[model samples]
Target: MTQMRFGQGTNRITGTVVMDRRTKCLVKRIQPGQIAVIDHPDLDEVAAEELVENRVRAVINAASSISGVYPARGAAYLIRSGIPVVDRAGADIFCRLQEGDRIWLDHDRVGKVGESQAVVRGERLSAQTVWEKIHQTQSHFNQTVVAFMENTLHYAVSEKRWFMRPLAVPGMYTQLKGKQVVVVVRGTGYKEDLAAIYHFIKAERPVLIGVDGGADALLQCGWKPDVIVGDMDSVSDEALCSGAELVVHAYPNGDAPGLERVEKLGLAAHILPGMGTSEDVALLLADQEGAERIIAVGTHSHIIDFLEKGRNGMASTLLTRIKVGGKLVDVSGIRHFYPPKTERRRKAPLWAAVFSAPMAVAALPGSFTIDDSWLRMVWLSLRLWYFP
Candidate 1:
């Protein structure tokens, strides 16, 4: 990819427009140096990172980039990365502009080429403004938290009765009994978290469960998910066709929109009827199927994450965590869980260790006159660093 300085332009940009109502879907089609037109309100961190990865020339949002409801930082991220974002561009602009149409962004104004009048004009989000709004929103954090808890409890009461009933789990071919399971989600910093756990995954050989677009994340990292779970909205067709077992999460009313997509692909999927989020279902499934331990990577675990995902209540997640808390561990940044590049009982041969002792001592800082006690002190100090 070429280097990009997003907001360094002359307050103007002219490029082919790539428009999509869904920002996640749009990222797949967007190319560097192309303009992106999206209608996402309260754009979240994941979408912003994806957009940054694509290196779009600029972003034009038909909806508020930061609604000030709770400080969604999509605009801030783009701005900080030097990306110019024109916010609240008219919704009808989507109707007027076609994909691949050349357009012009003149500061706050957007219009098609050769047109004297601008199609839509919105407030340009600058770093100062976005941060100001974010700080202002922070002041209301307590209020948002209180309301969030109240709503969660309100919904939890109604949803608890459903949990009391038995959940009909689909028969799965993939074995989970006594196996360590890694449930992946496309949350903030998921890529980094996955990278941090690379050695742990290689050594332990955990069962990989990708939640929706997280399946694509695994495929990108050269790991094929054993079970792909979600409503199948953000995941790509390539991921769905990766020979992974499809377990679609269905609603309480038995509506399975994701199942329809699976059927269209000629892929067989087991429908899991549940009331909680798809990630919750994935965890509960693994726990019930006898997974010895569940490692959650990028799963939403806090109130802000729930708010960003547009969930007013995390009752299902709350209940599922309570049920599986014994074996569940969120390994988002805990890379030290396992030593790097080493597995249990896989020490070097005794002959190799003995043969290298002299060479190891020779390579140390001290001259050959160094005492044996000093060498031992240094060796002990470096033992942890040599784990790799």
Candidate 2:
């Protein structure tokens, strides 16, 4: 095993190095006090949140954390979380350092312990620098918007069927006809929004759909998805075995890579080939199932959400919105509107039970009848117990 060195300075951290070119994949392998080596450029907020949750000792980036193309609040999140981040450390670090190799990440350099030569040297990211970069990038954000719009229109023209016609979605066991369906995606503020709508979910009993890793998110919240739909790359084996109806989102050519993963796990899944993204397919599936209303949590709707996913074109999502318009409500809107409906519906049953209880007692035989004062007392007791 490789040995690590611990120094006295606050700016130095020594730990085992875990390297992956994919930020999300690396996050799964990393542990607390381990050094994460990743090649993610323009790291988004979701990735940063995972890194912070894992409590990695430090992050060494082969690519620039923020390319100034967009706000890319990931680096800012890391810095704010007090996790040291070394940016633009060069791709050579991957070739030079092996996984599980112990290394020392100093304020300015990273290298194997007891070595005088540094393997990767890069600038440490500070909150001030991140804030400044974001401010500078925001001023030029119009260019990004223009480019995104162009790409969206270009792809929208090619993929207009998704918006124009009804999707041929596979039959699902979960009945959604005239029922509320909540489609969950692993996007910004998903956790917060899910938590905020917890009462609504319990009260309304909506069909829950998870898109890829969104299944894991739902599981984390003590809820099992009624349907899990996506590429199946990010979801865990346990989630695959979760008994939810699996719907693999395939390419336009009917190539379903996620199906193999499901089969390997000895699980059956329905293949749904579509033109748009997995989330788009999810919404279309709900609509096809005759869902009365679709509540979306953590689904990206904004241009920045698409750009952060490195998607310049949101043709699929744009078309999906057009197709599901007036039926889909975002989490924010749900939080505002759903509670009243939930409360109203919840109270109706309680009120019915309350009124029916007295009627039920009154329907008893005359021999079982009690004084008016006793009956009033019983009603009062029932009211307190049921309403409280």
Indicate which candidate wins on lDDT: 1
Model 2: per-residue Cα lDDT over 1-388, one tens digit each: 2222222246667889999998888877788888899999898988999998898888889998889788899998988887888999999999999999999877779989888678979888888888888999999989989998999999989888646776667777789899999999989868767876776676578999999988888898889989999999888777789999999999978899889889988899999888777999999989878899999999988887888888887988988988888999977334444344447556566667667886978787787756666676666655443442
* Residue lDDT tens for model 1, 1-388: 3334435646667888999999988998899989899999888988898998899888999999877778888888888776789999979988989999999988899999888689889988888888998898888778888888998888877877776666688778999999999999998878778877765676578999999998998988889999999999999999999999999999978889999999999999998988889998899889888999999999998887888888876888888887787899897655445433344225544456556767878787755555678776555434432443
Worst 10 residues of 2 by lDDT: 1-10
TM-score to true structure, per model: 0.85, 0.84
Q: What value of lDDT does candidate 2 attain over all alpha carbons? A: 0.84
In model 1, the number of clashes is 2
Stretches off by above 4 angstroms in model 2 are 1-9, 332-388
Worst lDDT run of 10 residues, candidate 1, spans 336-345
Number of clashing pairs per prediction, in order: 2, 0
> Measured by C-alpha RMSD in angstroms, how accurate is candidate 2?
7.4
Residue ranges of candidate 1 with Cα displaced over 4 Å:
1-9, 335-388
